[model samples]
Structures are given as C-alpha cells and as structure tokens.
Target: MSQNIFIIVCIIFVGLLIIAEYRAAKRLDSGFLKWVAKPAASLAFVLVALTGGALDTTYGCWILIGLVFCLLGDVFLIPTGARTFLAGMGAFAIGHLAYVGAFLSTGPEISGLFLIGSAGMAGFAILALRWLWPNLAEFKWPVTVYSAIIAIMVATSFLAAPGQSSAPNWVVIAGALGFAISDIAVSRDKFITHQFFNKSWGLPLYFGAQLLLASSV
Candidate 1:
C-alpha cells in the first residue's frame, strides 16, 4: 500500500479510538471499546512497519520491537490490578529502551543542543516525580524508574535521526513530546485524581503520537 493510503487508514483508526474512548470516559456502555482501540492503535504502527519501507533495516526492526512492547503495555494496563500496572510499566520500559537503541544506532553526533534537550527532559522528569511523591506512596519508586526511562526516550527522539533539521526528525520529536504529555495526563488521572476529561486529550495525543512515530519508520 502507498504511504498516503496508510496514513489515511491510520487517521481513521485514531478517530474511531478517540470516539470510543470518549464514550468510555462518559461511563457509557462501550463494550470492548477500550480493548479494541488499544490494539488498533498498536496495529497502526505495525501497518507503518509493513508499508513504510523500513522493516529490513536493523533500525526499523528496533522500532518494531518498541511498538510491540507498547502493544503489550496497552494490554497489560487494561486489566484493573496493581500487578498489571507494574507489568505494563515493565513492558513500556523495555519499549523505551528499544527506542533508545534505535536512536543510538543512528550514531547521532553529540552536540550542545542535544545535551540541552537531555537536560530539559531530566528537569521535566524531576518535576513530575516531585508532584507525584506525596500520592505515590508505595508505587513511587516504580513510577520514578518508568518516568525516567520515558524521559530518556523523548530526549533521544530528538537526536535519533541523522539530521536535526529534517522533517522526519521533527516528526519523531513531536511524537515523543505528545507521548510525554499523554503519560502525564495518565499519571494525573490514575494517581492524583479521577478526571474523565483526561482521557479526552490523552487518547488523541497517544494515538497521534504513535501514528507519528510509526510514520518515522
């Protein structure tokens, strides 16, 4: 399939997911909606892998691995249990590391700008941890570790591609930022308070980010 067709299909899936999730947020009887949407989100990435013309390269494969782990994380998080949450975190951590590997494989040149971005990511992680510390109680450490890994993933996304000025590079960076924002919404809704509206923004950011990352393939 052509890239244009793939993009259009992905967009349709994302729209469907957002609508389903919004209904779920409203406490409507959306049977299997979340389940369907989660996997469909991941499947969009798989489609990119198949059609983006990059599956043969090691870098592409690494990204594929990350996306698979993300699928696993999504599934694991669906069940309501602390164990499942931890399992999801582990899966996503591995996914982030895989993404980091993909970024390093490009042999990005170390620059002051890159270091600054890394520092910015670190600062955001620190602030998020500080805000969650009081409510974290038992899950503090695990969340901290997972957050750090995700921050690294976002930082690396900026430097993953060879050229900083390229459209692909910016797309990857935007996806990473969107992922970060979505996660923050998740954390707030899950740990601090129960806000249904969080899903409204978070779901779109998440699927959009995944679609953008998939396109990077």
Candidate 2:
C-alpha cells in the first residue's frame, strides 16, 4: 500500500480499537463486544504489519509472527477461566519469544545500552514477581517464566537499537517499553485487583505498542 493509504488504514483501525476499549471498560461480562470487537482491534496490528511489508525482511517477518501470536493471545483472553487465561499467557509468552527472535535477526550489539536495559528489566522483574507472588497461587511458576521471557524481549530490543536498520531505533524501544509497562497493569488487574481502571490504560497502551511495532515494518 502507498504511504497515504497506510496511514489512513491505521487511523481507521485505531478508531476501532478505541471503540473496543470503551466496550471493555463499560462491561464486565463476556459478550459480542468481547468476542468480536476485541479480536478485530487486535487483528488490526497484523493488517498494519502486512501492509507495511512485514514479510519483506527477516526482522519484519519475525515481528509479523509475533503480532500473530499476540492476536491469538488476545482472543484466548476474551473468555474468563483459568484454562483460557493460561492459554492466553502461553500465547503471549510465545509472542515475546518471537520478538526476541526479531531482535536477534538484527544481529544486535552488546553495548552499554544493552547491559543497562537488561539490568533494569531484571530489577523490575524481581519486584513485579515479588508483588504478585502472594496471589499467584498455582500460577507462580508459569508467571515467573513468562516474566523472564518478556524481560529478555525488552532487553533484546535495547540491544538491537544501536545496529538494526529494519526500523527506527525509537520505534523498537518505545514499543517494547510500552508493552512491558502495559503488562504491569494486566498483572495488577488479574492478580492484585479487579478494576476497570487497569483495562482503561492497559488496553490503549497495548494496542498503541502493537501499532508502533507493526508500523516499524
């Protein structure tokens, strides 16, 4: 697609995402909005990536794969149940690993930025896991593993920033950080407290992050 057309499509889908988030914030029960609008919003990122020529390069291809897995994660999360939640988590974990692969495709340098980012992420992971430990119950180990994967994903993005040419460094950095921060909201909603406040901010951050990453393609 032409650049103008791509921008217009992105704007339209962003509107769709806003409507979906509004629906989610207003309702607690699962219904048509959850099953239909939510996934449609999630699918927007994949469309964005494809139209942006995500399949044209190795980094873009891996990012497209990650976006697809994240879409599945969004779908799996629509329903409320332990099995479904676990399924969603697993999908997201895989998505993070795909992101790691995408960064690796850039042949990232182990610069000071990488070391600092890794250390910062490690610290955040320790704090977050400790906070969630009390309520994790049977999900403790799984959550831990997922956290580790996501931390690595973010760190890898930092590592790739100085060398990757597939996308602007700011796009990758902002997308990764936004995604990681949004997950804190998810964790709080799921394990700490149930509130619309979490979804209100988390959903937007998530979709924005995905859109940014997709546009990078």
- CA lDDT for candidate 1: 0.79
Q: What lDDT tens digits, residue by residue, belong to model 1 across residues 1-217? A: 7766766676676677767767766788664876786677677676776687557666677787887888898789877688998898899899889888887777777766678878999999999999989998889999999989999998888777833333227777888888888998878877998666777788778767877777777
TM-scores for all candidates: the values are 0.90, 0.89
Number of the top lDDT candidate: 2
lDDT per residue (tens digit) for residues 1-217 in model 2: 5534544554565465556556666774436645666677777778888888888988888899999999999899877799999999999999989988888888766788888889999999999999999999999999999999999999898855423353338788789999999999989988998877787788878888988888877
Task: Tell me the alpha-carbon RMSD of every candidate.
Answer: 2.3, 2.7
State the lDDT at 149 in candidate 1: 94
Q: Write down the TM-score for model 2.
A: 0.89
Residue 160, candidate 2: C-alpha displacement in angstroms: 2.1
Model 1 Cα shift for residue 52 (angstroms):
0.7
